[model samples]
Structures are given as C-alpha cells and as structure tokens.
Target chain A: MRISWITEDKHTPSVVEYGKVSGEYSEKARGEHTSYQYFLYSSGKIHHVKIGPLHPATTYFYRCGRSGPEFSFKTPPSQFPLQFVVLGDLGQTEWTASTLKHVNSSDYDVFLLPGDLSYADTHQPLWDSFGRLVEPYASQRPWMVTEGNHEIESFPTSYPDSFIAFNARWPMPFQQSGSTSNLYYSFEVSGAHILMLGSYTDFHAQSDQYKWLQADLANVDRTTTPWLIALLHAPWYNTNTAHQGEGEAMRLAMEKLLYDARVDLVFAGHVHAYERFTRIYDNKADSCGPMYITIGDGGNREGLALTFQSPASPLSLYREPSFGHGRLRIENETHAQWSWHRNNDSDAFEADNVWIHSLRSSKECWNHTQDSSLDVHDEF
Target chain B: MRISWITEDKHTPSVVEYGKVSGEYSEKARGEHTSYQYFLYSSGKIHHVKIGPLHPATTYFYRCGRSGPEFSFKTPPSQFPLQFVVLGDLGQTEWTASTLKHVNSSDYDVFLLPGDLSYADTHQPLWDSFGRLVEPYASQRPWMVTEGNHEIESFPTSYPDSFIAFNARWPMPFQQSGSTSNLYYSFEVSGAHILMLGSYTDFHAQSDQYKWLQADLANVDRTTTPWLIALLHAPWYNTNTAHQGEGEAMRLAMEKLLYDARVDLVFAGHVHAYERFTRIYDNKADSCGPMYITIGDGGNREGLALTFQSPASPLSLYREPSFGHGRLRIENETHAQWSWHRNNDSDAFEADNVWIHSLRSSKECWNHTQDSSLDVHDEF
Candidate 1:
C-alpha cells in the first residue's frame, strides 16, 4: 500500500497514532511498535500525508505525528457505500481522455485499472505521460492498476522491475490479498468484498493464487458483506470474435469455485470493446449468476470490437464498438447503478448510458437454481 | 531526420522513389494503422526505409499508397551520407528508457539533440542511476548537444536547457564558452552549416547572443545541394526571466529573410519538454528550420518552460530547476542525428551515456574566438 500526505507545514509539530479508539493510539502501540511508521520530508513543506495498506474490514484510528495539535481519522467503516471506476485498454488517446474527464467529474473514490495501461510495454516516457495525464485525479484519489498482457515486456527481470516502479507510483491494497505480489490481490470496500485476480499468473489448481482464491472465498462472511466482486483482465464469457475462447482454459480452471461462491459481479477487459452480460450459469441466463461487464472501451489505438458471436447468445446483454469507460455506484446493500459512457468527437452530452440493479433488489429478475441439470460446457 | 516506415506485410509490393531512383520498401508495418498518423505495435518482423534531410542529399522517391510503383529519387553531388537521429534532454533516467533503448539500437546514420540532458539533478539518481548507462556503441561516434541548467539543477537555472540536454546528447562544436546564452545557437556539421543560440532572449543588445550572432548567415546553393541549420528555443536574445532572452523582440522578429534563404537543423525543447520545433522560420520553426528538435525531456516532472527570457546575470545559463536529455550525431549535408533521453532510473549500465556522430567521415575541429572587452556579469 502507498500513501501520500498533504500537510500545512513541515514544522507544524504533530503526532500520529492508530488504535481501536481514535484518540487512543499510544495504548495500542505499547507492545507492537510495528503498528506505525513515520517519516518527514526534508526541505519542501508537506501539507498532508496519506497512509494505507490497512487490514480489510478492520477499524483503526490514526492521528498526525507531532505535538501541540494533531488531526485524527477513523478508518473507513467496514460496512458503507463504496464506489469504483473500472476501465481497461486505456492509453493516451482522445477517447480515454474523455472518459477520464467524465470519471473525474463524477464522484469515484477509487479507480481500478484492470490491465492495458499506457499500452504495449513500460516505456518510461509513456508511463510518465500517463502519470501527467492522470495526476489531476490520482493526486487526490487512489488509482489501483493490474497488469495486462501488453505490460509484459521482458520476463523474469525487466517486467518485475517495471511492476515495482508502477506500484511505487500508485497505491493499492496489495497486502490484504495474503499474496506478496501485486499482480493479484483482494480488498474490501465498505460492505463489499472484491477480489482482483491475476490473469498474467499461472492459474492451475496447484498454483498458490488459485489456492489462495479458494481460501479467500471460503473465509468470506457473506452474511456481513453480502456482495462479492471479482475482477480480471481476460473475459471468461466474451462473445467477441477477436479473443474467442481465449480465456476458456482459465474458466475451466476456476469458474466453478466462483459460481458456487455466488460472486455478485465479474469485470474484465481485453477485447478492445465494451460488452455487458446478463446473469448466466451453465451457459443459460440465471438471475442468481454473477453479472459480468466488459469495459474494454477505454481508448486505445486498436479501435473497438464491433461484432458479437451470435444473436442467440444468452449471456450477451449489450455490446458497442465505440470507445469509453464504466462507472459503478453502490447505493445500498442490494442496489447499485452501472453506466457506460461512449466518447465520440461530438459534444459531451452524447454518452451512452445504462443502469444495473442487484438481483436481490429486483423482484422481476429470474432465478436459476431450479435447473440443476444444466450443462456448463454448452455455449449459448 | 529519423523516419520509420511500417507496414502490415513485408511481401506486399511497395516502392519508395525520389528524384530518379526507386527501391522496394523492405519493412512491414506493425499493426493495423489505428489512426492516419500512428502505427501501433510492440514487436514482430521489422524493416526500415531511410534517407537524408540535407541539401543535395540523396533525392529519392517513394510510393506508399495504392497508386502503383512509379516513384523515384536522385540527389546532386552534395548529398552524401544521408540519415540522422534527432533527440534531446535524454537524462539517464527511467523517463528516458524506451527512447534511449530504441534510438541506441536503431541504425540511425547520424544523430543530434540541442540541449539540457542527463542533468546531474541530484547525486543519487544522477551519477549512480543515470551517468553510467550506455546504448551499445552507437553513441561512441559523433553525438552533439547544447547545455541546460538541469545539467546543474543543483545550481540555479544557470546551466540553461541549452547546455544541459545539449551536452549530454550531442558533441557540439563549442564547449567551455563564457557567453551567457552559450546555450544559444548556430554551427556546422558535415556539409550542413547549422546555427544554434541560447534562449535568454531579453538582454538583447548587451546580450552576447544579440551582438555576436548574425542573421542571413548564408544562401542555399541549389546546384550544390546546400543545407543550412539554425537552432534556438528562447528565440530572442532579450526578454524577461520566463524565456530569459529569447531575442524574440529582436532577432526572431527579423528572421524572415533567413527563412526565405532556406536553413535547416533548428531544434529546441523547453516549455517543459517534448516538441518537434516546426519546420518554420519567420512565425514557425518550419521547413525553414525545416527540422526543429524541441525534445524537452518528457520524463521531467517539472514544468517544461513555455516562455522565454533574458539572462538575469552573466552566469545565468537558464532560469528553471529541472532535469536534462541529449542528442546523437549529425551526418553529411542532409542527415543529422537527434534523440531525447531522460535521467530517470534503470539497472542498465551507463544511464547518461548518449551521443551522435557523423556516419561518413570526421571533420577538423573549429577554433573559438574570444572577446576580452565584453562586459561579464556574475550571478551564481
């Protein structure tokens, strides 16, 4: 986890504490001094300091690190409304620029970039350019990123170094996932539990990530969080001809675990298009199945994926060949709104919009548990 | 000028012709042309097409469109040794990675960058992280550049963008000069006579750039394939601190006659890095400057200067606090080298080792004329 702070002055003398009670940090730090760490900037005056990597679902108290006066904050509640902006394949293109502007204008507390950032390799200049472009928003909010195929340049060496550089620049809940690697991790945003899977890593049953995923899912207290979100780079249910069946192997490896766990949402990108799917279980529409959304429209030079596999595809709800981004807003325990905005050269008002409601909250939604004999291998 | 010709297929019949000679294009374009201006891809089968931008340089013809193969190219005796690389402020940093690696590995006939590169910004990232970096042996030849202040960001902008990026990138004809705009312009490499002057534009008259510099340096002899090189960023020799003395109020405002005369090799990048100085003259750096290099180190997080100014004191080389970049080599009458590498971070050896040299034959060094009577102002 990375944290940036803003302070009014460097010599303002303040102290920071974290514990069960907002004003009782010193008591909590009695034995485990490792609970807190402090640093000071030498020359330029610091106006603020942001700290993170806190344990998921745990409440903690924190305060400034000086005498005379101190600012305190309670960790975000374990159960509260959470908002995330999801996107992929975003580069320094006109469409990406528009999506960023729109997202920034809206109220997203955090951003999730599921692969294909800056695009095709980690060029320092390109990354710097990307940083400059995103600084307006990231400087104020958290921007978490995942690796895509394009980000892999040299293996075993440069690739890992680039990832290190990326992690240094952006903060994420990497430690919460129990995996030391940032390529895959999980975090809880208020009442919702989210798992970010790493498609770039080995996903075999014997791999540590798969085992960790299973352990994580099994330990989740569904009665408390009530919602589970899984995000990855490759779409397991995509009908786009470009990457047809490309992720089938991965699906065969882990889909059943996610299905049985009743995951609420699945987000993915890679086909260079925007696509959303209705609830599906075993190749058939089922209200109980997790909703899957593909937001690959984040501006890339590759244009968009315009074709769908077939009209009879039960999972396919909407697909557009244009470029844009996605926004997800959770209003309560069982209702949320999702929107997709397409960015054309025209004015800003011409955005395509959509809203997705939770299955528990929608009385008209269909249930699929009655069909126990459905074959999961059949393609719609 | 560094030019890359990319296509989707290598076997597809294609030709490039200029003057009276024509040849089949040998390289394949990477990805589908996403936009009319850019070709996208990371790696694959690759090939190249090259030529010089110098006068009497190899005149050639090329056919890219589907209009059939009837293109040709020819050049007068003056156009020998034709290709070059243009770069700037390529400090040895992560910011300079992609461009440095690519340009260093590519077969650019020659190279050149104006100024402010490999800035010894700080001790750690500078000497240890960037200084030792090297790009194969391509830089061992003839690299030329001006100096900028970031070369000594530890000092004030006294180093100026001119000397910083310039010194690191290229091997200019003059060094260790006492003139304030020593960051300023004008010179000759190969058959091309180039001009480069510092940006401190405000202090026009008493400003060394104004008094010692002469306009209408020469007229291009079409029969001899004459090519002229004129370079400067803060154009005027006098102005405020923003642009220093760009000479905009004096020399630049009166450069139309020189533009009509056809000069080349005008390169500059300050306003916070990265701009291909237009091939203009009077109002533009245009084809008159035909090929301008505004390779401000895009990697620099600091603001790339957008304005020009005159020197505050004689020791003033530049007035901003930032980093640096570099250029490569200049070859023949038509081709010159250019590139921009930043001083970020990388494990690679010799981060700050960037250079440009003529590919054909070496020339004798020129003599410097010192003026003892000139008034010298001190401002460290």
Candidate 2:
C-alpha cells in the first residue's frame, strides 16, 4: 500500500513507520517528495511512501515522518463478501461532510470514486485541505479514483499539461496494470475485476486507454473474478439534460468493447444527478450490456442538476437529483446487492435498492460470442 | 535496450530473433504493440521489443515479427571516446535526406535529437514515413530524443492529451531513472550524464520535471561522469529574432538548477537556425554556466530563420541560417571536441568547431560551494 502526506518543511525527510499495533511501529520505509506550482502560490512538500507485501484484511498502524500522530487502516479482504462505497463529485463542502458521514455509517472494503474529487479546479492549495478533510475516512479504507474534467487544471501558456496536481498527488497503480497514464487503470479485489476508465482523455479506437482496456478485458478470467464492473466520469446513457451527449463520443468509440466483454455495470459521475438505466447499449436495451448509472450527486458546490428530459427514456429505470451515495455489497460470486441512500436531515434515506446477478453467471449473456458478434439468446 | 518498430498486422507475434553472427539466430524475445488514431485514419500496429543483458558495444543481428530482412545494431560503448551526432527539427524533405546522408558519413556511437523529429503535426501517417526514412541510420545506432512542440498534435475536443504518438513510438529509459513522465528523463553515456528535458511541459519550480531534475542532478557524481549535458526544445539564449523570448519562462524556472549542477552543455531546438553561445549564465557571459547551442537547422520544411538581431549579443559566438548537424566526440573525462557541419550541395562543410573542458575538470568550477552560491574565481 502507498501512503501520501504533505509537510510544510521541504527539507524534512519522508519516512513512514508502521506495524500491526498502535504506538509500536516496527517497519520503516523512506519515500520521496515533490512540490506543486500555481500562480503566486508555492505548495509545501508532498510526500508518498509505498510499503506493502502486507497481510490482507489486517489492521496496520502507521505514522508519517519521524514525529507525528499515528493512523491506522485495514486492508481489503482477499475473500468474498466485500463491500464498496461508490460516489463522485465529492468537493469540500458542508454537504460533502454529510455525505462522508453517511458513508461512514457502514463498513466498506474500498471507495470507488468515478471522478471530481476535492473540486480543486486550479487552486492547488485546496488539494492539501481536501487531503486533510478526507484523511479520517480515506485513511481507513482504500480510495481508487480516475480523472474528471475538473481535474484538467490546465493554464493556457503557463501549464499546458492537464492533471498536473491531481496526478502528482493521487497517482493510481497504473503501471502495475500495464497502463501508462494515471487517468485509467484496473484492480481486482475480492471477486470483482474493476476498470477505472478515463472519459476526459482520448478514447478513440487508436487511443492508449482503449487498447489497454481491450487487453485487460481479454485477460480477465470470468471464473476467478465473476463480477466485471467499469467506471468513468461522464455517463454514456443518461436522461439528464445537463451535459447531454458529453459521453456519446466515448460511447461510440468504446461501447462495443464493453458490450462484448459482458460487463455487468458501468458507473459514471458528471451530470450532478442520480440516474439508473437498465442493461443498455447503443441507446437500446440489451441483456449483455451494462447497467448504466450516474451517481455524481455527492455534495459538490455545483449543486444538484434539477432538471431531466421530458418523458424519460424507457431505458432509464430511475432518476433523481439529490445528495447521496451508493453501496455495492458482493455477497458471493454470483449474487450482489446494490443500494443508494439519500442524505436527509438526521440520517440517510434508502432511495433505491436492487439485487444484481454477475454477468458471468448468466447463461444468456455469459455464452455470448467472443468475437464482435453479440446476439442475446433466449436460452436463459 | 528497447527496440520499436511498426507492423501492419496486429495479430502478428511481436517477436525478435537475434544472434551474434549473421543469420545464426540463437535467442528470441516477445514484445507488444498498440494502434493509433487520427481523424478517420488508422495506424499500423506499433511494436516494441526489449532485449538486453547482452554485452555492450557489440554488434547483434535481428529480425522483427518472425519474418523480415535481417537488421543489425551496435550497442553504445560503456567506455569513453564515444561520439554523439546531435541535431533537431528534422522534417521529411530533400534537405532532411541530405542531413541524414551527412550524418551517415561518419561512425557515430549514438544519435541525440533535441526534438521535432517527424513534423507529423497531426498527420499520423507522416510518423511512419519518418520512421522508414530514418531506419537505415536509426536501426544501427540508438536515437535518444526528447519531445518538441511539433510532437504536440493535440486536436482539441478529440485528442486533448499531447505526445500520444511520440511517447508510444519512442519511449526512453525513463522509469529506470525514477521518472514518472516520458517527457523528461536522464541517462549516462560513456563519460557524460545527459538530461532530456521537456520544454513544452511544465517546468516551474514546483513542477514534476523540476523536482525530478533536482534529484537526478544531485545523484550525479562528477568523479565518474565528468561531462554533464542537457537537451530541450527551445533555446534559452539566442540572438535570432525568430524565437526570441520563447524559452524565457523555462530558462527563468530551471536555469538556476542546471547552473548549480555545473552543466557543461545545453542543447536546444525549435528555432530553425544554428547558433552557439560562449560559456554564459543568466543572459550574461559567465564561465560557470553551460555553453548554450541551438542546432534546430536540420532541414525542417518551414525553412531556416534567416534574420538575426542587430548588434549581436557578445555571448553568441556563432550564428547562421543553414541546414547542418553537430557531432560531440568525448575523448576522455576531461576533454571533448564539438563540431558543426553544414550540408552543401556536394558535401557537408565543417562550419564551426570548438574544444570544451568538462566543468568537473575545471579547478574554478570543481570547488564551487555546495550551496546556491556561485562565485566564479580566476584561480585557474
């Protein structure tokens, strides 16, 4: 696992000491630090330390640098019955705090954020503050995220490259999965193989992300990881008017690949609203296609996207504009429960619920042709 | 060493068979490939094969994709007395052919390009042509290059990220040196420690490139690699009015780091002209700084930058608007010879020559304080 923190002193050494018990750190690992730039702003040293080969599902207490308060975290389990908290657009706001509180209501193995974390925009210092804000919950569970349009803090002539601060601070395990960019990557946890795609980057047939996704999906053995899920920023299928057709280009470029892979679910966040669609592909319903869901209403400053298209499409099962989060509890290889809870005055209200079957376990979709041909049969 | 090539067949096994002698194949290695996109154009499968652990400075014959004409390349010598042919802005044209013919006239250990290789400029097919054009010389010698602005074929709303083709095609040994980005990296050749910096990317004090440079330079021991060299796209100091102040921001951001490291030479491209500066620092003549050189005049189609500023700066030693190339021959740890050859109709004429002393070998520069204080003395 990799641990990252910031210090005001650039000269201080980056050292992380950790063990299984509190107040007794047995192992020590040294890390590296770098600085970030914004107009007339100078950031402190951002340090990252990677210490692993650790036992899964075990608690580890760690301290950053030589002298500091110790923090503890539990690694994700390697067996079944793991849970994941899925949310996005989690900016630093009072509602964000409430959403986090609701998320803390239950135990999750990991947090999957499609995009738009912190909403730093271009103010680089917000990243440091956001780090402090999420340290409480994020220190306990792993947070795997991809980039969003907000992460592209590109300044015209000064900073041409996008995702400078985000990439430097929130680097994912991309190289481990043969990915060259931090914007996209994949990781296997418990019985699920999850792909975090990049909607803001190039996703054409020739793009690196597309090629990587193809190789990654082809290498996935459905027997080991039966549940295959994907996440990106913009929703490919949506009834919301805001940011309409934003992801159509990406969908046109890469929808068939996911459809052919028999992906069970595709979660996206960008419309600032919550909407769930039935298994769909190419703007139509298909059993082999993934369940498209937009869960961007995680208490961002942009407020809720209050409007939807008149006479919702048949593919959209449910749609709402509210601050909430979702949970995916994988009970076994073939069964899983998905629930969305909306933040209310005192507690979070369960707005929607569903039980899903892994696409690998479905006779109709599982036996689909490996080639480009996708003909859903009635043999289920 | 990583060898890269292009194949039309995506399913063709990315295999390389090699041996010490002609056609006596003894070892084979498998590689990987990916496709590229531009408009409606589709690219061939770009293949990369990494094969090493063999003896350096030895000739090895190899064939690509199981069936092809056998090709051979000589690994760079691990010892001193190595030669590097340096040029940049090499666009495909009749003049480019002449420059290659001139470069092929002598036996060089490796080819060093500052940037602007293909001038593809959004036309992805041109990259293949450029690769084919340089195969004869490039296949035999290792070509070490950084990115130029021309490599940024970013189509807004489609290809937002730059250097998709350049990075995928010509990947340097960046990860081995702890660099996270392919835009910048450092390597050691013979008695020289060379740094390939990205002029188009972020170079502020807090940028990743700046921080990586700090770590890389601090780890360099002058006792072993006495010659320190740096390469980028834009020339920091130039008398030509064409690209005046183009590299000023980068120079202001990173010049101090290189100066403090006692870099011996700084090579740059972008301005289509050839100019060499005396050992200077901060727009003034100072012996402690590197001898800045602009050798972008390697037959770019845009033509040469013919106009030079009136009342030439005293620091600029030689200035010309001609198609030419340069050769840096490192004879030993302390001494080296630099020569520039201009391509005439019949032959490449030797235009400029200079003998350089490695900064580490100079008594005045060798004992400079480790702090930021740089006070050159006349204690020679």
Candidate 3:
C-alpha cells in the first residue's frame, strides 16, 4: 500500500509512509496534484498517492512528508452501527469553537457536511486556513460532504465558473459509486446507505445528476444496508423564513424520486437555523415520508436565522435559531437516533432529539406505493 | 485534474477543488488516506486523490475538504535556474521560527532539509506539531528531505525497527532511482541533481545503499543537469568538537565515489554549528574535491555546539556556532551562490557567503585520477 499528502508547492512530490504501526511501515505512495493557485500554495498542485490492500478497523501511523508528528488514523469497521456527526453552513466564527468542541467530544465515527464549508466566498486564503482549523477533527474522521451555495464561490473574470475551490479540494467517492459529477454519489457504512445529493447543480429531469440519482437509488441493496439516508444542502421542508422557499423548486423536482425510493431520512442545511419535520410528504406528515432535518446553524459568521414562517406549519415539529450541529447514532439496522444541538456561544445543548425507526423491511420499503398515489394532506 | 490535502484523519476523504483563479473550476479527485493511527486519525486511513497535468507556472485555488479557505499554489516553471533554500537539524525551538522566517523571505524555489526535523527523538507527538510549524514555508515550497538521527525513532519490542516515523511520513524518491532503501535516493530539479544519503544506515561496500550510490553516480548525465550535489546527516569534515569525526568511517567508504563522480558539493548536519570547508578529500585540500559544508546549526532544543576542534585545520574556511539555515541560488551551469543565516533571536543576518564554481566540464571532472593517487596528506 501507499500513503499521501498535500503540499503548498505544486511541484513538491506527495508521499506517505504507512505500515501496521509507527515504525514498522511497508509501502509508500507518490501521487500528483490536479491544479494549483498562487494565493497559498506557491506550487499549487494538489499532490496525492494510491495505496491499499488495507484491512478495515485497523490503526496505522503515518505522516504527509518527512516532517509532521507521527499522525495516526483508524480505519472503519466493515460492519454496521457507524456513529456519524452531521453539520452544515459551517464558518469560522467565535461561535464555531463551541460547536467544534462539542463535536470533538461526541464520539463520532464519521462526519457529514452538506456544503458551505469554509465560506471562503472566493477568499482563497480562508480556504487554506480552514483546513488547519478542521484538521483536528476532519483529519481524524471520514468527513463526507456535499456542495452548498457558499461553496459556489466565483470571482469576476478570474473565477467566473464557480466552485473552483470547492471541487478542487474535496474529492468525494462519486466516481466509485457510479456518478461522474462531484455533486452526487453514494456510499455504505455498516448497514446504512448514504446518498450525498447535489442541490447546487442541475436537478431537473433532463440533467445527468437526476439520471445518476435514479440509478444509484435503484442499485441500493437494502437487505445488506437497511437504512437509506439522503443528504443535500437546501432543505426540502424548512420552516424558517430566511430561505423559506429557496429550495421549493428543487424539492418538487426530486422529492418524488426519493420518496418513491423509500428514503428514510433527509438531512439538509443552508437556512442558518435548526428545523426538524416529522416525516413530511408534500407539506403534510406521513409516516412513510422521509424524516426531514435542517441543521444549518453550525456557528457561521452570518448569525443564526431567528425568523420562521408566521404561525409555523403543522408539518414542522421543532425549530431553533442558534449555532450548533447534529449527530446520528445508528444503533442497528432498523433503529437510529438523531439530535440537534444549539450552541449558546460554545456551550452546546441538545435542543431536540428523536428516534427514527424504519417501519418496513428493506425490500418492503422500496416496494411501497409512491406519494403520487397514497399521500396528500395539508396538515399533520 | 483535481486538488488534495492531508487530513490528520484517515477516513476523511481527500478532496481538492481548484480552478484557474477562483471560480473557473472543473475536476475533483476524491481519495481516502491509506492508513491511520489510533491517535490523530483514529480513522487510520490517510486520504488522498490524484489530479493533473497541471500547467507549469500556473496558480490554482483549492480546499482540502469542504472546510478550509481557498488555498492556492503555483506550479513550478517548466524550466530552471531554480533557487532552493537549504536547512538541516531544524527543530521546534523558538530559534527555529527565526530561521524559518529568514528562509521563507529568501525567495528560493525549493527547500532542502537534511534531517533532524522535529528533534522529537522518540516523542512522536512532536512530529505532528512540527508539520504545522513548517507548514507555512513547506506547503509553499517543495521541502525535500532525508533521514536524520531524530527521525530514527524506534521503540522496544513494539517498534524494534527504527525510522518507523521517518519512513511512514517521508517517502522519498528512492524507489524511482533504483534504491530500495528510503535511507537514500536521488532526484533532479531544473538543471540540478540532488542525492540524499542516510548517515544512520549501513554504508559498507556490500550494503545496498553503497551499490545504489555507485550506480546513481555512474548514471548521472550531467550534460542535461550539470549540477550534482549530495546531502546527508552526519558531517564528515566538521571542525566543531561536537561530532568531529562522527561520519569519518562513512566518508572513507563513500568519499571516493563522490569525489570521483565530481559531485560539486556535499552538505551535512549533526554538528550543532556551521562550518564551510574548502574543497577537501581525505582531510587534505584538493582543487577537485567537493566543497563540503556542515550546516547543523538550525536551532533545536539542544543548544548550539559552541566548542570547536581548537586550532582549526587550514582546510576549514569558516565556522560559526549559532542557530540558522542556508540558501543555494544556482546561477547557471557552472556557478552557484551559497549563504548561511544566523537567527539572532529573530533578526537574521548572513554569517557566511561564497560562490562555488565547478572548474571543469561534467565529464572532464569525473575523469580526474582517483584521490589515492592525488597525493593524500594527513598533515596538510
């Protein structure tokens, strides 16, 4: 097997020394970077390496280059009950420290961030700085992520095409899961299947992402991984007023596919608030509908969105405007717990908690009738 | 092409999004780390991705994961006259800061560090901290390195094998050059070829390294890269009382090959002081001898080696007891300038300067008679 790392200098060769332990190492991987920019990495090419035949649930020690302390990481177990931490719209702010501290102590096995990561907004230096900021936690866990509006940073004439920094650094496992677009992909952890969808990209019926999503959902083998959870940036059912109906069109376009595919949960952010809906299907509560949770308040510079739609809709169960994150504890194939926390300037407290249990068997869920035939209601 | 970064966490997938300026972006290489330790990357798999045929001398913007600011690095210019800063025995001391600052502002192309990086000895945690310490300059430039005593950290039965941290972190281009040992390797930059040797490894005639060195020197096509320089850990011709003859045996075993190959310069450390040697072979001055320089004064926790071999030899041109680093500015095919800076607290000043010029053509120099017939004098 081999190892890897990133160098500010694009020309710097990327190498990683890895083995079973700290000293007794075996292989080295020397990989190359895709591109570079002068704002930070004078030699801006991202260097990488390929290595493997690795065993799951193993611990190994390695470093990026000749320097750095002996960094160590543990591989995931090839089985189920993966503990994951979910976050979104995270920015570096005085409030972020608390959310991060809470996360560090939460005993998470993996991390899922649905975009708006550094919020560099085209400020290249911020992107570099953000890496070090999260290096403590991100470097330790398998932090899976998707793009958000903030990640669509672009500069006039200089970077007019957008997501330059976003797509350049966060290379997800999209290709391995059958999607060429960095916007969407699928992976498995224990018995749960996670689909990271793209809200910033084209979601219309004619788009490639839509077709990929259909195939990805169609390919899921629920018996092996009973849980089907989808994550994206914009919430399909947010009660907050900030981005009240910002994603309404996106929802209308893809909601039926996810609903028909028997997606058990949908996690999203971008409203700068925390909102949880009780299995909503077209603005109404339906047991078969996906449990929708919006956890956008990961302590960003843009204070929390405190305003909600006047006289909250019946579909809304709980909503909080504060800086914090969410956590998912998958206890088994059919039972999982999710909690939304609000950071009172770093003193985080759980604002809401729920046990989401799948009602039908893996095969039975996917075989259920579509929302177009069985679900239609204006209120819970 | 794609961009990437090293997260302390292995399970954390590697992702780099980059584009020309800030917005115009395209590719993404989502990779995962190979191995992780139970410590930092409890998810012990170093994440990595492969991207590129990046344009030379172009800058691109990227972020490691969804977080971090947009960091940019420039690809090296396709052609040379590359200026590289050289440093050795650098550790995490207050004095190291000054040395690094001086080297950073020196405006060099690549960084050459010949071991004793963190001075962590066996304290592994220091290795990780040192990465951040040198990240500012290292990430900006390709900091090339070799093994030193500090990196030879080994444990009892658990890690009876030494350099565990070294090999795991710094995977040199040894394999590329036909050297199976990470302790030795060779690479080319612009018009210069660098040979990084290991002082801690076995260098006897029958050793793999010796054979590799013989083959490497024999294969150098100096016509393309007219500059040939070798660097190692222990100094063979140091005037300092500290480690005065630490590498004497190594010199006796390998000096003839280097001298015969017309390796213009030999750099080393392990003597906590700086000393510049006039062209010497077997303790005697010779016009064709490689200019040997010992720059082990890059401050570490171990204070400077103030004592010297009293009544210094005539072959020694200059010597200084201080903490600092060096710089090499290759002007053309035959001439290059070298300078050493002392970190006077933070205000750095040049301690010595010299212009080293290779007198004969690459082939002509190598054709010179062996040192044994060149009238070796111990009492020179």
Top candidate when judged by TM-score against the true structure: 2
Using DockQ as the yardstick, the better of models 1 and 2 is 1
Worst 10 residues of 2 chain A by lDDT: A371-380
Residue-by-residue lDDT tens digits, candidate 3, B163-238: 7666656566577788998888998877888999988788878888988887776677777778889999888888
Sort the candidates on lDDT, descending order. 2, 3, 1
Where does model 1 sit among the CAPRI classes? incorrect
lDDT winner between 1 and 2, please give it: 2
Going through the candidates in order, their DockQ values are: 0.03, 0.02, 0.01
Off by over 4 Å in 3: A1-5, A38-43, A345-349, A359-366, A369-380, B1-380
Angstrom error at residue A115, model 2: 35
lDDT value for model 2:
0.85
Note the Cα lDDT for every prediction shown: 0.50, 0.85, 0.73
TM-score of chain B, candidate 1? 0.45
Residue runs of model 2 more than 4 Å from their true location after superposition: A1-380, B345-348, B369-380
lDDT, candidate 3, A112-177, per-residue tens: 998789976544656776776887776666788999877865322223465777777777778889
- lDDT per residue, candidate 1, A1-380, as tens digits? 23333233545432344555656664222110111111111122222233444554345555444433333332333455667788888877777788788776656656878887875242334555675576566554556677665554321111223343344433456666677677788887677778888776767788877878777776666556667888888788887755555456677787776776667788888878888888876667776678888888888755677776776376787787778777777877787777776666333343445555554344443133112112222211
How many clashes (backbone atoms < 3 Å, residues ≥3 apart in a chain or on different chains) does model 1 have? 189
